[model samples]
Target chain A: MQRRFGDQEVDICIVGAGAAGGVLARDLARAGLKVVVLEAGPFWDPQQDFASDELSMQKLGWQETVLVAGNNPLKMGHNNTGRGVGGGTVHFTGVFLRFHESDFRVYSQDGVADDWPISYADLAPYYDRIEREIAVSGPKHFPWGPFAGPYPYPEREPLSANAVVFRQGCEKLGIKSAVTPLAILSAPFDGRPPCINRGFCNQGCLPNAKFSTLIQHIPQAIAAGAEVLPDCTVTQVEVDEKSRRVTGVIFVHDGTEYRQPAKIVILANFVVQMPRLLLNSATPAFPDGLANSSGMVGKGIMPHSSYDVYAKFPEEIRLYKGTPVLATTQDFYETDHTRGFVRGYTLHAHGARPVAMATGISVGAGTWGPQLRRAMLDFNFYARITQVGEVLPSEKNTVTLADEKDDNGLPLPLVTFGYGDNDLKLIDHAVAKMKEILTAAGGKPEFVIPDTAHLMGGCRMGADPRTSVVDQWGRTHDHPNLYLAGAPIFVTGGGVNPTETVMALAARTADHLIQQARRGL
Target chain B: MATKSHYPHYNVLDAAEDWDPHTRKIVEARLLPLESVEHLTTAETKTLYSVVAALIDDDRSEILDYVVKHFDDTLGKRIGESQRKTGVPPQADLIRRTLSGLGKTARDNYGKPFPELTVDEQHTILGQLERGQIPADGIWMNLPQKEAFTKLLSLTVEAYYSHPKIWSEIGHGGPAYPRGYVRTGPGLVDPWEAQREE
Candidate 1:
């Protein structure tokens, strides 16, 4: 019953069917290039596979063995990332905000992290194209766009009570707030239905209203002659011994190994696995790892540090009645050194599920038994505002190969992480601001949920070959045909969700490859 | 008779999806649908039962008996499986060692094993373990006593909440599938959810 792919050759081979890989596959296939998308996890139909269950969602992440080390331990195989063909997009809350212009010129503006090789202007057209393709809903005049482009779809109406409360708090604090732009459909577009406000966005959106890569790009790629082989784990990206060009990829499918040759190879397996795969593919020609001559493959790993301030009101708020994160206050998004942090964060209304809240309370809410019972009774009366803060890239926080091996006999990725001093200051300031805003809205501070969101950096992109892994076009400096397509190419992670930017970067890279092919490179 | 409810309009189990495989599997796991105890030794089962009885409410002897088996199976699989040396001992060894240490402490102090001790005596020993105030020469000296206590407490809490009876008491809308929430906006509750007690 197992399908097999032999030593076949293709014009393009993308190693992850994620947000990036899906987009890249679609673009390349549409451009008349033969594309093969090799996904480690199976492609699941939303209606057939997804359900609003906590335990099932718990098992959705990469369950293969991974080691957590360093001062701040990473919660691997958790909600951190997904393993399905759609990748993390399948389970995301659909908050798709564009990176600000300053996000690219971080080194120049803040004198902190290295500046990205490409600016927001370079990515704006792709962002617009993707927004239209994904049918993103936002305000009539979206105020947050650094380039300030109009949204293709109308804004989702009737903001959830949780979002309203957050807006009220922002108004009380005299801070700027707006409806968060989301990739979730607001109106029926391109034959897909609009969001029904089911509230279980993280459970993979069974209604298919959310614009995950599963629903958006992967199908288009398949339709346009791309071969998407799901449940195929790429073990190594084989390179020509003399030319140092990526020749093909070796993969395992259903316990059988196969080599699929490629004219161009793209690695888009998110952050951790992308670096891990490259490191595992180290040949005698390039011992440090493929495309790792800069020694920057698994360095500067940044997981966005986040904090939440929950509040309890007298009236029934029913926080989990709509989309999880529908609105936010980005007044503190820009940098201000007076706050003792180089960069800032955005505070968004977080509509958490009852079970998620219960788990949060059970873990560290400082209440137990009878007291916990009282809190659970008033579950609908709770609302939270979470700070998605920016984290500076540091070489110390890295993803290295662990000595322990997984089920496939591959070395487990050891994620070593610790909060930088600036990151701590940023968190402290955000918490204080959130507490103040909540108090002004006549709400009592209940508890704080400290965690990280959206992993980024590692194989960062820059103009300088010495300090970076890939060029502005996501082509690895060491190899002509090898490319990276996800957040791993980010120079500095912004104070918001990075999926939209990741998609934009992927589109840009795909365009570059297509243009190069047209010029007969 | 069925328990009188504050939220009389809502069916607490309306969210439980029988049609969806993922939700159904989760429901089965949460319910701990087991025919018999497969993993726990007789003594280990007795100790866990005693601990659960002390930590959670005592009204349900039926639920605790079943819940302990799930705990036992989970602990058996997880113990010594951790790749990282996270300062805590393996979960299986942690349970066994902690139980033995508690008994030793009880016998040395009150001339009885933990199960036979009075509620106050049990509380005293547990409180010391929780606070990491156990003496350096105590039986739990080698272990991260506070962390072990927390780990056990968390497990007990998880097991306690997994049942439907506890969910009803806590006013939870059990599952949300098949009939997914239509009223997900602010101040709106679906017919199946708990009504506000006015």
Candidate 2:
């Protein structure tokens, strides 16, 4: 069940095993290159891991090791990321959508943002490759977005009855809706089972149907003879000023120190950790940080303009009986000036079971005992209306090294951000629409819980080396051989799941990384 | 009780459909429906018992009682009013048995947060429930307070997963838009990872 590598050096060093890091590690390793991935977490096995009991999940650090940093406070402020070998991709919702062509050029189009160095056309093929490699499910022909290749209809997990009804509501509004493109295995494909829709995905899939890098990419990396060190935490990327390069990475495992030297380094540690890691690795040449030439490694933070709406319907319907997340409405995916919000909002929809529903609506207190026992019966009749809006880029919304240190004596990353007035306006707008839909379905507000998902930013992408940490290829301006991957490089939070885009970008960089490695960069 | 209520899915469930607006695919353990849930899940169950034991060790009886009393919950006010109306509250022993099963964990039987944001918002939510703000698709439980433990628990362990972080000693994390960022603040060594060697 375990493999050993005493002192192995490699062609590439992948810092994290999340979406981008995992995929890149697998691809490069398959190319017969010696790859080493240092993950600062545990590796969960499907057979021996993934418990369904709620109590276990709570105690097991929610199956995530990306422990509490100073940045996110209040509520479930941080979307849980797997600290284990698979990383965030293990816990992702598998909703894969291409970045709208305009998404790459929001600044040019809307005069509100900076453009990604790569265009939609340039990254289109990588998207297709990832779609096929990961087995994405969706219509090949998307009428809304422009991209190459035919839609690979991978799998469609069972749609809950309520999801169908919600589709009707979207149609009634005449919004452009499509079968969500997802990484969830719809049928038995690539040695994985089909999704049976137990809707406990966030807890980790018992069935191999969900597309986690741990299942898909990491295994491939191993088969290609790559060294994946799970439970290994990379602390700093040691800089060599004489060579103007990253000579090695210093980390701790058990109680030992490890120095992983590599020709090429990829800072794929996600948006949050990317900046912190880089900032934590301060040197004489880069006293500010590793790639602090711009002082922008932790700037331009944007949490998905995340918000939610809930309506209590008149039915004992079980929402948690279906997929953890089914259909997401990206009807307003592209930015429209009319909406008052610069980046538009993507509507994510779902229902819940009695316990889950009670969790949401049970935010209030009532008489305990018999009085409480009769409280409205099973909270079966409710739906959760949620939206992910684009939070505008602001240097003020940044992730910095907090004064407090972790157990490792490293400064804990502090995420400082607040919803601005514009965000408030957008939430108000989103709430109105959500209310209308809920009321139309004959539901009324028991309450609304506003929260954000995919907490992004702290690291952003741009063309200006002085203003941005990474270029369009996700290469750090300061460290040419090093690349930054994950949602942190996201310049702006798109109105949809950023996983697909992250994969596409990683794939594109994988090709470039191969070229550079071949050239002996 | 139902008004111009359009459809249950859109209003309460936030239903999302990929192919059509009327159907959904619920993926499970790949077994045919009923047979699937029948399979004994040793992993989650074993882990659950351990967590329960730990919770009980923490001596948090209040939380256990809350989840037990509120389990199999019908969020509307019908259950409460019915219990009060029946006038015969259930025995204390039943509560003890149920609480013993849950072990100890914080239960937000009381309104948590947004309670302090505004009094009006708090009262409005409670008022709606008491004054029949119940949604149409909802099932009403008419149980005598103490005796009609029609269903003992409404939710599974997963239902309470979001509780400890939101309403307890643990806090939320990450940078971006954190709902509740844990400020282990400056100068304090994070005891959570204290075991991790430097």
Candidate 3:
């Protein structure tokens, strides 16, 4: 039964109805638990709200101010984070990939970054479940990762010119490449039609072809008796004064404050907001923060060193002809000490729209005036390759509360991030490889746009309470009923798209919560 | 003088009718006339217009007016990138102060307003601003010159390329929606896609 805000306590309250929260709400509510979800942004109806224009679709991203510091100040919004019910999934490129076995044991294999509390074997089943649920389409035999063989849906066909060029280059270099595993539907599933090669996946899919939590999990969650409150921003997580267990959450809806009491509270927001909320909810009982026993609420944040290498091809490579990323190679995904970098990166044949291409040239190459205009005029002849280089975790990179307040009268988050020496070395190696691949495919390598994406960590999970905020099952070390169910719990960010892993972790967390409920805890 | 396009035969608006209703509405809104100036003053608006024209290397009044109005709307709504480098003010404040500084720099250095300066002189001042070589005086004090220049350039480029006219010039296929492309193979082209004249 759907429970509303009143004096009675509900079974669960999940904050931020994005990837993780959507899954948790659906699973818990289906099990007969009264669940309520609070989302900070509007609940969009894809057909009514989505547009093909890049400038307008940027509304899907979190537009609140975040103060950035450090040598390489990270650019927030559209590229890295998201707003609204579906979160980043609504605007993401839909590149669904599973982390390799080595990604789980980064410390043991590469001697850098901390090891995940759980192994790949623990997540492999959940990964399989998520791929089937979302109908991920890919090659019959995946070139990388432990689990191989046919995905739930067949691979997308008629490769875009950019993908074909990238594969040709990889083939010439004797490197293995494959059609990228994508959450985008290639065949009709669950009444939704297949992709029509719109090439606006990053601008929010208009045809309902791409899988997002807003269209899939959230609807199922609502049908399963969960009350999903959109445009409701949770300000603080309330805890019991004596027991120290989470009581519920205080949120603002339509300029009115209300409290929803629940037996359990899960923070499913991403890297920046998750820690910001915890630190903001500090009380006298837990002076530092709610889950600050280890003092690791907002430390060790990592963003993959994503850099795009644009090459000019003689042929018309009209990049915006199909999905943004249709093909990728994981040839350099494992550590090779000979390369002077501790970890490796994945290369994708990424597509670019006109505005994105122009901005990339202007910001990345510092090209302006006549030179910038000339580059954009030949935009149709460019094929781009982007690298997702693994960045090592640094305690120096953090998310702290700023003195300035936001529109909600809460302290704004000040995000500090800078690439380490190893991270820079990894980027250099990846860029060289990208240029070599483009050159081998009969293209002249031109601009290398330095950027980053996929923010993770800040509230990591581990077995030790002294060093980690949550346990392997996402339960907070200090509070038994307070859990985190998204990228914030990541111990190590793998060099691939993170949505699949995020959903898989949420599924596992749901199972754990369901088991605890069965025990009447 | 209007900037000459490499692909003059292509016009992306020819296929505008194929776009979905929501997408078409959003794209069409860009071409609508501005009702009034919401963010910048008249002087600031003229300064921004000149700066955008110099940054994009385009002199067409229609394109310049649209770009300036689009930027003004972005500032008024506070929809631009909210993340800022430490110590830098908000985007609106940064842009306003930088425009004022550019005008003052032109008057002090060349004895004229920024818009009245020759194209070559304007380019030189812009280069100095981008390289952080300009002296910090008056409104330029504590200002991040390179960051400000990059922000201005990025915003201008975004607005310039977003125009359907620029899309035609760049041979871009605008807004594929209900009817998406079928010929996606190497060197293949849809009938409505841009074709370069040999």
Top DockQ prediction, candidate number: 3
Q: Candidates' TM-scores?
A: 0.90, 0.71, 0.98
Cα lDDT listed for each candidate: 0.78, 0.57, 0.89
Candidate 1 lDDT, tens digit per residue, A432-479?
888888777777878887777778989999898899999999999999
TM-score of model number 2, chain B: 0.20
What is the fnat value (0 to 1) for candidate 2?
0.01
lDDT of 3 by residue, A170-277 (tens): 999999999999999999999999999999998899898999999999999999999898988899999886998999999888778888888999999899999999
Candidate 2 per-residue C-alpha lDDT over B1-198 given as tens digits, one digit per residue, 9 for 90 to 100: 222112221211121122111111211111122211122233323322323323222213334333322232222212121111112223232333333222211122223332132334433433433444323221223312222222222232222323332111211110101011122111222222111111
Q: Give the clashing residue pairs of candidate 1, or none.
A: A161-B186, A321-B184, A322-B184, B15-B175
Ranking by lDDT: 3, 1, 2
lDDT of 3: 0.89
TM-score of chain B of 3: 0.93
| Cα deviation of A22, candidate 3, in Å | 1.4
Interface DockQ of each model: 0.31, 0.03, 0.64
